[model samples]
Target: MQFHHHGYVSGDPRVRPAAGVGINRPAELPDEVDVLIIGTGPAGMLTAAQLSQFPNVTTRIVERRAGRLAIGQADGIQARSVETFQAFGFAERIIAEAYAITEMAFWKPDAADPSRIIRTARTQDDPAGISEFPHLIVNQARVLDYFAEYMANSPTRMSPDYGFEFRSLSVSDEGEYPVTVTLLQTSGPNEGQERVVHAKYVVGADGARSKVRESIGCTLAGDQANHAWGVMDALAVTDFPDIRTKCAIQSGTGGSILLIPREGGHLFRMYVDLGEVDPNDKGAVRNTTIEEIIGKANEILHPYTLDVRNIAWHSVYEVGHRLTDRFDDVLPDERGTRTPRVFIAGDACHTHSAKAGQGMNVSMQDGFNLAWKLGHVLEGRSPESLLSTYSAERQVVAKNLIDFDKEWSTLMAKKPEEFENPSELEDFYVSTAEFPAGFMTQYAPSMLVAAADHQELATGFTVGKRFKSAPVVRVGDTNPVHLGHHATADGRWRIYVFADTALPGATSSTEEFAEWLASSPQSPLAATPSGADPDAWFDVKVVYQQGHPSIDFGAVPGVFKPQVGPFKLADYEKVYATDPAADIFELRGLDRGGVLVVVRPDQYVANVLPLTATAELGAFFAPLLPERKAAAVLSAATEP
Candidate 1:
């Protein structure tokens, strides 16, 4: 059987003597899917896994490669990515499989400078009060495997249709779920088949060379540095005590080198400047041949003599820094609307130097940010305009990463003479915390406009909200329960009752609010009798003064309101202070019956409505509550 469509052929063609190859195409095609994600990397896979939890939507992932491999790529997980892993339900197992790097030591290569040997540790003792998760070092493939396992266990079993590569896409301006994709299955037993996939939305997570991005005609706009770096993964047989510690060794003769410890005993990654090696040579570094790379490594670590043996895997590649000019196209005059019904994220959206190990984390978070919005819109719970926020929110994140990568690349390439000022080194450390933490916050809903005000917020209560999406916190305990451990299947809006104590007013407020929410026609909140019930729609918890659970609060400064603060009337003063404006009540038209804080699905405060404003509740939820009737009407009107 042969199938053919648009110059591509699949299957065996048995035509006379020396016949041409034939192609096969499926007769039926899916009319439209909730989401069509391109690429099977961490970004695409995780998005598919998150969306698979929603039964009402269909999620598909496509990959160019046919199978998973054990090669090590990214070897470290920042504290934030670990927290994300917790949400995806694989933090513990990942922690067990990865090596924990507690300390990082930097050394100077000159034997003449003994002081450089004891370079101050960036994080001497394991950082305290930084995050719930510690810094972990694991292979990138292992992390991908974990996600693959989770998706397989899920009811949806989100396996990518491998060998199927995206060829091109067509978009509609009429806005009737505007994107259609043409895909070709290029390999495997049933290779050369063509299929058309129609989707309400498309996510371009197809890595640096994304075909989806190409179809959209979006160019990544940023600088690409000329430097090439050699990355080697090997086991060190050296007697150096600090070999066990992650370190950066800078030698005058050779070049700058970075050493990282991996999961297995003594396995380490050595990054060297390719300028130090002969450009024409291409060789693999393994346990037996690792000694060849060690000579250059020794030159980089001049004062400390090192031995190399037992190498696992290694590769060399050029590094670059490039960020897309726009996250997605914004059509003129359509202030809140995005074009093509298509979005690009992850490496597809931005590519930068890999010094800080941010590519994986940022890419994963990008998927996280896009997945929820796509799921909700496909399920008919949110407006198509909701998709616009992905670009609005993540574009900033992409820019920040590019900027940090530039600075970090400079810092890594700095000479010992430039490091005389301790303040300069301190600034680099501060920058590290800032970039990763900021990227992590993009996944948080509290940073969005809808999460700004809690009362009028529609989607804030679901798994999408930052507070609700974040790990669980015991009322009095400092340690938090991983949010991933909780059952987050319900798609209802969440109402968190922040109260002083179990007073009559507090109890009455909680009960009345629950009752009102249960009865309100516009309310998406569901009533549950027991607070501890796993299947409860509305999550209610009282935060008392003595031992209240402290929220992560994310990167934005003023999401939390302080109990005591002076009123600042000036614009500049308001911007400088961490406190919300004292007259915010007037701004949001709220009155104290314990203000109803409405946070959006993305977790940014949407509005602050008074608990007593029952009459205005309908208008508040107008945007979030699905207008099935309106959708039906629109569908009917738009139908051919």
Candidate 2:
């Protein structure tokens, strides 16, 4: 939201003045580029959005579709995705238009009648209150449109190249652009024509039947779960009281339905259990008709009746759980010496039942995680070793998602009598709510993610997991805000220094630490290119335990008020005071003495340390950040 640093912005601030590659950008695909991403799905669009932040890197994304996705199959927006939308500067807008899932009701056959259905239990969607963001239900296409708008207004002005279908790609160890790709024109005058492009790295977000995955010899290696479900987005009138509410209904003899209320109030999606499919009847379930699905739904409801008005969309899908061995082209034998040039993401890496509502949420995270690493490596901000961590971290997360979805999908497919306890479905849903809400993903220890040896320093800010936001008051404006909200997807590491019980500018631990960070050559701030913004490479902010009234804004350290933009205006938004009503220190379990947290560009807590541990702080960022010598080479290579 901060603007006008360069000069007065009389026009809309959201539309940034395009620069570099965005200035009168080429109309056709380049012969060579920094990164080439395939597909315009959830993962692909997010990848483009993140890479758009780096104007210096030439990134191109192509989709087989003639234009943008009109209607996407996925609609479930988990709480974690809403947090990501906030980072991209569109959460409020999307939430305003999205359906907020507040509670979920479970239904079973009536014990007295056995022929009718009755509500068994009802639970809050976010019972644990894991995130301040809500569980949303919005169209997948709308999410893509938001990202597209953000990209258009970004410095890079990125947009997907439509009608270009990916055919194949090959990797070489010898050239700057090691990955050579073949694309087929699916529309326009060049239809059926083929062309070639080369890239330093390539990402395949091309979905389950990804051509990029096939060219890389990666296989989706799991079997069908022998269950089929018919899903439809419909406008219907029904006596079922929970039609507007999310419901899990299991009939005594018919089947089950996982009903999800959609955004426009009157519309909702239903995943009608089409019963188990025989192993030999692979594609048979797809033939299940909409009328048949409605009949099954009516049977499940028993005494209730549904008058279908309109059908927005419908599909029949067999539940299958599959995952690739690795997300990149690097073989197991080539792990040490080789760097991955061709990579796959989203459905290319993992596939599971859509019933869990995880397909889009998880895929978007795949793009978010990989884009930062690719940006770092391409821009020479980090070594090639950083690229290896993407597959290692995300592959494990995908596996965990598959496991959870498998259990949830199986439970939904069961008959009411099959469960030892009639409330088994509701119990399981309540118990593992966090996982489905997208807060349970914890990346294991790696070069990027540090071990939890110092976790107690900020117990709430768990390492290897997403940084949870807490309320704090900005010192300069005295406005209450979330600390994590200040951290955006701008490809800069965050250094959040939680000050000890001391006033700003005082001769205390915070003062000494701030001075050293602003002056020390070993500090991560030194990595910022000369004449660039002081916080170009690292965003340094300080939060004090003291209330806003006790702090003098002018006395805050220079590190928290670094001069930015052409005017060299002091950025006063970095200094914050704990909210009196909800102190972040107590809420997040931060050590009263002081603690320094290192958060990656993706908003995951990377490391935690004592504020006075200057050497430890320097050591942590030393390897991740580029030295002046390496940055100079990057400058020369990137010069226009």
In terms of lDDT, the poorest run of 10 residues in model 1 is 569-578
Spell out the clash pairs found in candidate 2. Answer: none
Backbone clashes, each candidate: 35, 0
Per-residue lDDT tens digits for candidate 1, residues 1-640, read 1113213434332111111110121223245666788887878877877776565566677776777746847777887677667666678788887887676676654456633344544654234335557678888888888877766555454556677789898887765556778888777766788778887778888889888887877887766455556677876667566776777666556467777887876688877755422334343222223455567666666556776666677655555678776665565456544433777888898998666788888888777777777766666666667677777777778887788778877667666566677346444655466355432343334223433344332233322224423332443234344322332323334344332223322344534554444444444432222221211223323222122223222211111111111221111110111112222222223333444554443232344444555455546556654541322222221111
- Model 2 RMSD vs true structure: 3.1
Best by lDDT: 2
lDDT of 2: 0.90
Candidate 2's residue-wise lDDT over 1-640, tens digit each? 8999989999989888888788887888899999999999999999999999998889999999899899889999999999999999999999999999999999899999888999989999988889999999999999999999999989988888999999988888788888899999999899999989999999999999999999999999987888889999999989989899999999887689999999988999999999988889959889999999999989988889988899999999999999998999999998988888888999998999998999999999999999988998888899999999988999999999999999999999988888998789999999999999999999888888878888999999999999999999998899999999878889999999999988986788988988777767777777777777778888888999999999987788777887777777888799899999999999999998899999999999999888888897788778887874333322322221
lDDT of 1 at 5: 21
The global C-alpha lDDT for each of the candidates, from Candidate 1 onward, is 0.56, 0.90
